[model samples]
Target: MTMYSVDVYSGSSDSIIQDSHAQAVIVKATQGTGYVNPKCNHQVELAKSLGKKLGYYHYAGGGDPVAEADYFIDNINGYIGTGMLIIDWEGYQNSAFGNTTWVRRFVDRVHDRTGVWCVIYVSESALAQVANCANDCGVWVAKYASMTWGSWTVPNMAVSSGAFKFITGWQYTGGDMDRSIWYLDEAAWDKFAKANVANPTPSPQPKVDQAKPVVNPQTTWTDNLGDTWHAEDGKFISNTALHLRWGARPSASTIAVLPAGSVIKYDAWSRGNEFVYVRQPRGNGYGYVAVRNAHTGEAYGRFE
Candidate 1:
């Protein structure tokens, strides 16, 4: 059976947990070394009094991982074996945000002190940053369907945890309060909280390499550069520097210059403005990148 959870911070009111029917309530306990959630102890006690499963998290301030971990452990030492330990790895005010090694050190220290591996919480786009932490810590991804407020009704959405074999928890929606789904039962949740040994680390993935970028193959076109380009829609990795533009035309303003080994997932490609351009559906509008000099038949990068 699926389990529901709600995560809260100092800004959250007690009524959120009091009214939530979620099976688990993860309370934010501390941030960096200076700030502690004043409502943390009260929230944990409230969750326990209601006989709900409990969790506590530390907000990473991008400080020294060992020092932050020590602060988190010192405050939540009593709840180490009982509540799920989490490290909130967001970019807000976090200097070491995308540095996976910082995350590794913090969680490793938590395990050293409490013998409990803390789960890493990050956005779906930042999954690759924490790929190294998959072995010892669980992944808690936050990807909302919409910011709209709603009941505990699960949205019709499916998400991948990138290189990680599977996600331990998915926070699917957030507005007034954040909601998540856990695939495991109470026994599994407790096992993760109380795990004393490190899990076997998996083989590391290449630094810039990830899962296959292409989805479907349609047709092919040979450019003047003698490079065969696939026509179907999918991801494209630039072997060299390329300029992304606002329009498919050369006269269009340059949006951003993507460096070598940059990856862009395009929705479609078209031959226009003396160039072959890939259309990237981003946000509300689309961004276009010239993949080849269409008139000269010169390919800009390898197309898969």
Candidate 2:
């Protein structure tokens, strides 16, 4: 269904109402040199409140790509792994640095740190500068306020059917403003959202008893990262108080807020070392939480 979505920036309206027809929104949440979009959180929460899938972008400013990527990632960490962390590349302020290499560095850093795939956003003139990288990452080419056949000089066709080959986003225009259409249909769009955005802000978790087992009738519970739950019940002493989530996914709902030094009975589901599944303290429910990395036999969870 070629879904409709928008890309906004600091100049865009602070208050936004969810557009049911729009499947998602890509907001400019950060920019070069540690500058952040003031309304990033509000825009994200508003879009999420309206049930719209959300993504974020950073306006590159010809700086240290790695450092800039780190800055952007830090700002969007809450929304990290939720959707695309776009590298908005037009050109560089620093004549000394090459745009393509820096863009790749930034994108790689983002992916390495967040585990969510990054995308590229470039103007028509700037597309060629990063086209080499675009084939690896989905490219959001921005020629203008709208995308129409032959509207821009750059060809909007397939470089290849690779990871981000298809111009997944073509910025078509409306009301003299910027908007984009996901090239794939509804199912693919949804699938893309889930695959790219593994985490978002969680909802409130339901109460559960600490000693009860965390399980469901079925045994096929896993996440995009391939971490399985309902494996085994294990006891963990909290190295620090953590926020409990409804599920193992980072975007799960927060069910319990535990303070440091609290001992928790949890299922020892293994997914690297940052995420842990614990039975709730009050009900027979399972909630996810992140803890400090366990040392030797100490309990730990992944944060980065």
- Score every model by TM-score: 0.65, 0.53
For model 2, residues 1-304, the per-residue Cα lDDT tens digits are: 3566776766566333354546778888877775788877878887777777777888777877888888887877777646666777753333423455777888778877866657676644455567657545766655322111212122332222233335667664322235666565545444434434532322222233546653222133556665544444445556566777776655777777878666666544433233334444446655666542211112343211
lDDT of 1 by residue, 99-150 (tens): 8689989988988888888888887768888888876778888765433324
Q: Which predicted model would earn the best TM-score?
A: 1
| Regions more than 4 Å wrong, model 1 | 197-304
Clashes of each: 2, 23
* lDDT for 248 (candidate 1): 70
Error of model 1, residue 21, in angstroms:
2.2
Model 2 compared with the native: what TM-score? 0.53
Candidate 1 at residue 71, lDDT? Answer: 98
